[model samples]
Target: MPTTEPARPAHHFVAGIGAGPANLSLAALGEDLLPGGLPLFERQPGPAWHPGLLGAHSRLQTSWVKDLVTLVDPRNRLSFLNYLVQTGRIYAFLNAQFDAIPRVEYARYLGWAASELGTVRYGTAIHEIRFADRFELVGADGPVATAEHLVLGLGTHPEVPPCLPPGGLPGVVLAERLDATLAGDSGATGGQVIVVGGGQTGAEAVLSLVRRGVRDIRWLGRRHWFAPLDDSPPANDFYRPAYQRFFHNLPDDVRHAYVGAQVLTSDGVSLETLQEIYRANYEGYLRDGRAPVMILPGRDVVRAGARDGVVTLWCRRASGGSERHTAHLVVLATGRRPAPLPLSAGLAELVELDGAGDPIVDHDYSIRWKHAPRHRIFVQNRGRLSHGLADPNLSLLPVRSAIILNTLLDRPAFTIRDEQVYTMWA
Candidate 1:
């Protein structure tokens, strides 16, 4: 018999960066499919999703069924149902009769799922992903690990508009920190507090301030009115796989325009949240002779600067002319921009960039890179323009993960059955 040599074991088949819901979904679905396991490199100490924004009353915008694995692999060990049952909260959760699950519950669920995945490397933040023979994820300390393939799901960061003033301002804060800041600041309730933006976060900030007994709150919006989210059945069809596929085939111009037109579908505030704000405002007015919330719609904050103790804001009104407001506090609920891909000079150059300078993500959510065939670099939540709004949404999370897994495995690992199509998307 001829002597045989032992083969060296590879580090990992796929290494995911940032263990947010998107990548977490991919991890749960593809865990068994990938050899050597698809480990996640998360910067956070542990699984914490939107920690700052985990308000007591805040709820998820999507349904509980749109969990990490249910949409694709319901029988998966890491499914939300399994977590609920294992944690002995399934009955309690069901009995609550919540239209949408609490944001904290979802956060806890993510933590549970992350805990079950033994391959997840928490507190391991990758500095940059450099490619040579394979992908090397380097952290600040030194080389973290290497893998044959890499997936980036770094998610989004709070976007501070250039219009906003300099940092270190006492009253100026992000929407995520609004609740905490207000709790400690005693004088804000009596002072003029301005909240900039009309999205869900903005609404939540306004609601939080109102609940905190803030008497003078000016909620500014660029739109004509603070529009409620279009959660209607037909509107929801846009979030389905069929619509996503339809959108993928459209011309760049058309896709861009459609996303723009359907802005309220994803960006608008929930109807329930909006109603609560209104009711709170009404009650506040009845209790004290003045309404707490002053919804100033059709106004765009063009310029902002803080000096001394006051924050000055100049708005370009839609009706015409500019108006100014000086407030003791200003909270920006502007929005979030996707976190930058931490790819090294070598790897970054290999990836194709679109006209907008974003990575050209294919239908499978893999970036069209130089070594894509052998070593794919999949992107999650950073493909709004390329993959449609649902790319970042939780509604189709498992479905998207399954798509990526199927593509990576080169087989129908997850049989995506999105049938009963009634609407004809043109």
Candidate 2:
């Protein structure tokens, strides 16, 4: 069904694109500042959270405590803890004694929060964003929505290897939306399955296939053994207020290097999950007498081709040996890049970017342009280097939202609403 076209207002106070957690956080913050309520546009039909890859065993890599509202304002009512309480799972979860719940659970929590806010405009895709005296948001199916301030939370773009042909190989799925892609057919049950990459997604894919009773699976990667995620807890200090101050003072080059060094490229699986994978593979090998899964580390795929339901991959090994492997399916666990902004050429030229083409944002998460006026056009997720390592992570949702809100309202000492608080005791 089509959305009822809102009577286009002369100008809205604020507008946000892509209603993911980051922008959702900003929307929550806006509720406090704008009694009239800010407008939000989402491309998806509803408050869906990565529906494609909503796997049964896919647990959140980050702690639940790092949800949309907690980190910045722990007392926020729209918190994961609050969701648990509302769902009557607070005691059940406490009894389970689990640190992190499944990713699907988190998605549900986000959906609940979104439902309560009632500010999001689902099924509304902003085709192009233009900034002049005011920000113009052209929708795919409705009248253009204009706002004094705009926030882009378009999210990350999935990265596929150039060697792979467009449209992707049949039976070969990029690990972006695993559950949706591999819904009915039992994975690897028909024949051998190959999973590429060495990130957390790759590892998770391999494990999921194994759990699905798919015995013939081969895991290939360019690196030897899954690289250990930086487990040092103290490193989190960089995300704190004091560290943000220190990081902001560093030179641009230094800041870039620092971020590149610490950011988790793949899903940071917990120690328990890591141990489960090891145990599952080890025990299966010992009992079945057939090593259905082979980890070919230090190998890179040169090319892949599919013929007659068989997908063949040509790879170069670290030992200077070339090998060819065939599989019934191949899954790419490669990560995502930043999504393209729907800005006009002229407006895009006005926004400043780093060497990598990422937006250069100021302290308040507003895109910094030599000619762009301050507080007129704001950005949410495109300021990783400026904000610190937590910029894109769920951990920084509240902080990013607060920063964007304060900037939009032009208030240096703005305070978040106390009702939204999710206290530790609560």
How much lDDT does each candidate structure score? Answer: 0.87, 0.74
- Compared with the true structure, model 1 gives a TM-score of 0.95
Clashing pairs in 1: none
lDDT of 2 at 65: 83
Q: Give residue 144's lDDT in candidate 2 (0 to 100).
A: 67
Model 1 RMSD, rounded to 1 decimal: 3.9
Q: Pick by lDDT: which candidate is best? A: 1
Q: Positional deviation of 156 in candidate 2, in angstroms?
A: 1.6
Task: Rate residue 225 of model 2 by lDDT.
Answer: 58
- Candidates' RMSD to native: 3.9, 5.3
